[model samples]
Target: MPTSPAPLAPLDQLPIRGLTSGDLTACADLSEDRGWPREEHKWNLLLTAGMGYGIDDPAGKGLIAACVVTSYGPGLAAIGMVLVAERYARRGVGRRLMRHVLAEAGDTPLTLHATPNGKPLYEQLGFVETGRAEMVSGRFTPTEPAPGIPTRPATAEDLQAILRLDTEIFGLDRTPMITRLPAFADELRVAEEDGEITGFAAAWPNMDTHVIGPLIARDTATAQSLVASLAAATDRPLRTDIDVRHTSLLTWLKANGLDSIAFNAVMVRSLPGLPGDWTRRFAPLTVAAG
Candidate 1:
């Protein structure tokens, strides 16, 4: 008689491992498996700038679950790109992955933009709702008379200023992610006043639309100017995740042309709230890397 097969290890004991550039395709495949867009471009950025974790399928079905943690120094980190295969839903795969991340993160403050379906699980894991972000998308329709704020394409000289402004408002140093914008984005524009950089935004390609993110400005007028300028340069319809607290800016985006797609819960763990000034922070670079 054939001997009984070895006992299957529990999902919790499946051995989670660190992901690298080599796992890009598999990560994209897992995204597709969950019916989410296979954003290989975004995956590349996260995998490079952040640490990725995943659990492999014992049956050879690619990654069972995966997530990325983008740390800004030791003070803050954003968790994103969490995905689990459709076949393994509700089997503790997601919870296992998250616990691993939390363990690895230790006491570092953590943040993430959680979808409606994801909020409950995250809440159970100790993350509290601090705010919300509305995802607006569409072909940007320019209004008569553009914003008065002066805007121009940013140059190499503007890098330091951008990083400085980003750090001040973002409440953490993002040298690693901000530095990649110059090469990664299709258009990097800055709002200027008397030759000093006042605001900046970058429009990067994500599938067919240009995603405007890291929208940093001195005020509402400057934020509108930066967005308008980025829209003017690109023919592709624009998309960006705007903080709901910025009512005027969100309303302007809607009236100008975009429609609300969905809202993401901005949840934080081990912190009272996200660091930095949310007033000047119009939109994040991407919810994934926030």
Candidate 2:
């Protein structure tokens, strides 16, 4: 007969501490073991951004059970990469970590991409749904050898151009992600025309999924082409967390036979001001300009 397993106890009593690359690696392994993407860049980015906390066992073995943290902004913050080990589920580790991280957020209302398992807990903490999105997956068809524009691996020289394009598309300066770009991802692609950079994409290798993001293009054609090229370059399916408002992108993804296997909430806590440009084009968000 199989041996009976030890019953899990409340993890609330566990101690938490700041993280380092060594401990961060172990924590990432725990995330991968639970079938989540093991993005070390995500961890380091959060640490560099603001704060990160990891829960430990009573014996001090440093078995990372839970983590909650965010990336910084002058006035805005993105609460991301919240993960907990499966063995410690429903044991209060999440609540404890959340209490600590949220407190660190101060009066700055935070935003995050929330998983289904996390919705209930976050809702109880005042997080609500903004909308639903699909993370599509598909293989890319080679770009048929076009001569309209030139593509090349992005370099430090192109950092200014990349930042400009990203800010134009995202309506925000994503300098933080760019600042640590070298350590965060394996590859970055830039599209150039007339000696000016117009588009870019970043791809990070992960244990569970290949995360690609912030695909900014001067036009839809470039966007589609960049997506195809990035997908072709990866060993795994490309993953992205997109807003529901991206209809054209969604339709193209779905047509390519990519599956929407999960959903997440775009939430904020006590948002004092709203984004005028975004809300004007996309409703259900209002008040003052952030």
Candidate 3:
């Protein structure tokens, strides 16, 4: 039988190279095959804001494994979109990719949201569980904009203010990624008070559903108003990933028609400083980006 296909080479010997725009479709296919939520636009955005690597098939067919590393300056780095084809599983592909990405990250504290299936491997690599995040989804009926919480679509003029708010809440400068939000998100809502941005949120398409996240606000009421504005903007199925520590927000989400559907462990390779105002972070931009 053709000499048994000459016995496929071990994964460790696969060539690793920097991933580029040419790899977008293959990367998206890999993620979708693994039931991930990433799409082409998200992959493109990630590639623009971060660096990615892939182990290509020796025959020049396509990628067999891939991983992405993003730095929020030197303060924080995140590793995500780690994927290996099922045919190549259990052959140390994930570990090798993690090692490569970590090397690229230098000494920055690393973080990632880990599914149960991924937790063991991450833990083996020295990641510790810091907390849990819940994935919530459902259709919601938009309520009238909350009084005193003036909201409007974000504009170029509002970019600086939004970046400042994000830095304070996320404890890292993610200006590069945040600046690209308008391209991928259907709406970027900003809540203003006293002529200043107090909160903001992004609503983006995710396969068959819409997701609203990276919701930052000075208080719970403002957060609710931002979410409501996003809901009013779309009647499609909606989803968000929220830290479980925010019980009040969780309750509000459920009351507003969303239900918790999944839980992910927030794992960190090193202890990064806490957000300047953790309470202001109502939701993360995405599990992978977090």
Candidate 4:
């Protein structure tokens, strides 16, 4: 009798390659297969502004696993959109992909928001939890008296001021990501005081909800003003992942009819903490790209 053919190597040892814009559909399909929203808009931004990596399935079932890393010039990088096909879960594919990204990232500190199910695996890979973000969603209810802080739609001339504030509070020059906001978001607004920009926020379409994020402000009042203004202009329910440390803002958001959704743990590898000023950084552009 002929000897049995050799068993194929585990996917964990398979070649992982760079993903490009062309792989968007497959990536979205993998997301849906794993019960996540397709997130095509978000995926498009990440693919163009960030580096995507994935491994193809031998069985021709699209990607076996995939992840995206948004780098900020060696000082920091963010790892997000990590996914593994459901059929391949618990087989080490996720871990294998993470290890590869970690190697590719070298000494640059990395951060990612992790769901509960993925937290244990990240910890095993040497990531430690530093913070949490509370996600809330619902139609925002206008209060009896609106925020006194003045806010208005952003313009081309406001781009530089917005970028400066974002960099100062975000702790990195995320020009590539910031520049895309005008087109990506349905509404981009800024809070002003004494003719100077004090804060900025964006609300972009995602499925049935309008997600609010990258909410940077000088204080809680300014953040609240930005969120309130953005929420007022949209008909769809609003969603945002607010840093849980902002108790006042989170509580205020809840009071205004945006129901609590979920909490994601902020995890980091090779860094003591995220670089931004959490106090003024009310929310991330999206937890995935943070």
Candidate 5:
């Protein structure tokens, strides 16, 4: 009997380049295959506009075997949109992409929300487990409001103010929300007091889950109100990723009946030069999108 043809060599060992439009399409298709919504098409486009790298198929077959994106902050860097084609699994493609992305990060502290399968790889790269997150889901009713705070859908005039709060919370100036606000299903609510926008939250309906995110507030009560308000807005079950560092909010979530799911891996590769408060008020986008 004739010997079987050799398996395709792993794409990991090759040098990669910047992603092009064609690569984005391939990435989208691969994303769909991985169970992500087709709406994730914007992720590739956003990654290209922001910061990302990828290894393309040499045959111009429109296959992006591996890819990664890094968003820069004042003194930090965040990794998002990481992917390795199913055919290229366990071939060091992720490692290669990470190594390259970190190199380009240029000393900014690197962080990401790693999946269970990715935890080992990140640990091998010197990343340590940092925290947990609770994906709270439940039937919620709004609590009685306190004095002097109001929640409402973000308006055009509120964009700059909301963005400012977001910058302060995430330690970076991100334009994605500002540009995509109109199209996003999220309410992107803001808390106003004395005519000033104090806090903001982006809550939107996912497939079966309604996700509340980047939920920043001036105080725990305000945050609580925002959470409750968003929940009341959606008839579907509500969910939000509560960072472990926010013990007060996490406790509230648990007390209110949101089950604690698995932990979210917060890993950092380098130290940043700025003050450490970035973790205090930092807002999360999502596991993959952050």
Candidate 6:
């Protein structure tokens, strides 16, 4: 016979503590139970670059809720990985974890890609919709290779240049998190001009589909080159979450074979400190890590 889960403790009495490496498995399990796409390596990257908190069951057997807040430079922070065990749902556990992370965010403006279910909670906490991001995926047919911009696989030597370009476009220094990407990415491609790195993109395996993202470039042509390179490298269906603000880019992506599968609101709690020039951000690293 299947066993019933133990009843949760009262919300007010649940103890919260800083999440550590020891909690990675439990946290991954929490996300898996909720049908989220995160794997252990992704959880490890988040934990390494940000701070997290969790609430344990009253009996101290395991976690019932958890959240993470990743800061980029001093101007922006992203809140993600919010999860609550089904047995503990509707008991204020989500709110408590969110509040804890918000306090940790301090004075920086915060952003999150909110699903319909999470939008209401975020709205109650002062978040307002700023924009929309759409997830697009499909079988990709490689376009004719881009010309004039030399392209090659990224190496350790290229990390510093890539970080600078990413910081300029992302409006914050995400070196800590970005530095860890190569280890998880199936391929990291860089675009160069006159031996100077101008842009880059990465493709990582996600379940059955491969995800390509953080595609930053100085212009549409360069962005297209990076995307095409990534698409050609993988035979599996490819997916990416792109900001809808770039109409031309969206149109081009559609013309290239990918189709929009899902959309989410980009919500912010304060004035967004985005760079004056964000045209280079063809796609975000991920809605969660934005």
lDDT of 6: 0.82
Tens-place lDDT digits, model 3, residues 112-135: 989899999999988899888999
Model 1 poorest 10 in a row by lDDT: 142-151
- What is the Cα-based TM-score of model 2? 0.78
**Model 2 lDDT tens row, 1-290:** 99887665456656677876667777778778679766675665555654667777654455646554544354456666667777766777777888877887777666666778887888888776665545565543342422345567888899887777555554555576565665676777877888998777667665555566656666555656666676667667666654567677666666664557666666667674322233112111000011
What's the alpha carbon RMSD for model 4? 2.0
TM-score winner, 1 or 6: 1
The digit string of per-residue lDDT tens for model 4 on 1-290 reads 99987787777678999999999999999999999999999999999999999999976778989999999888889999999999999899999999999999989999999999999999998899999999999989965334679999999999999999999999999999999999999999999999899999999999999999889999999998898899889899999999998999888888889899898999999889989798999999999888
TM match of model 3 to true structure: 0.92
TM-score winner between 3 and 5, please give it.
Answer: 3
Q: What is the C-alpha lDDT of each candidate?
A: 0.93, 0.61, 0.83, 0.92, 0.66, 0.82
TM-score, prediction 5 = 0.78
Query: How large is the C-alpha RMSD of every model relative to the true structure?
Result: 1.5, 6.3, 2.3, 2.0, 4.1, 3.6
lDDT of 4 at 82: 96
Please, what is the TM-score per model? Answer: 0.97, 0.78, 0.92, 0.96, 0.78, 0.89
Ranking by lDDT: 1, 4, 3, 6, 5, 2
2 or 4, greater by TM-score: 4
lDDT over C-alpha atoms for residue 16 of model 4: 97
Clashes of each: 1, 0, 0, 0, 0, 0
Model 4 misplacement above 4 A:
1-7
lDDT by residue (1-290, candidate 5, tens digit) is 99987665556556777766556667777676566564353564455546657777555555555455546554666676677766666777778888887777766776778778888988887677666555666655433333335788888988878777776766677676445654565577878889888777876666567777767788777787677677667777677777777787766766665666667777767652232344445346565545
Estimate the TM-score for candidate 4.
Answer: 0.96
Q: Could you tell me the lDDT of residue 252 within candidate 2?
A: 68
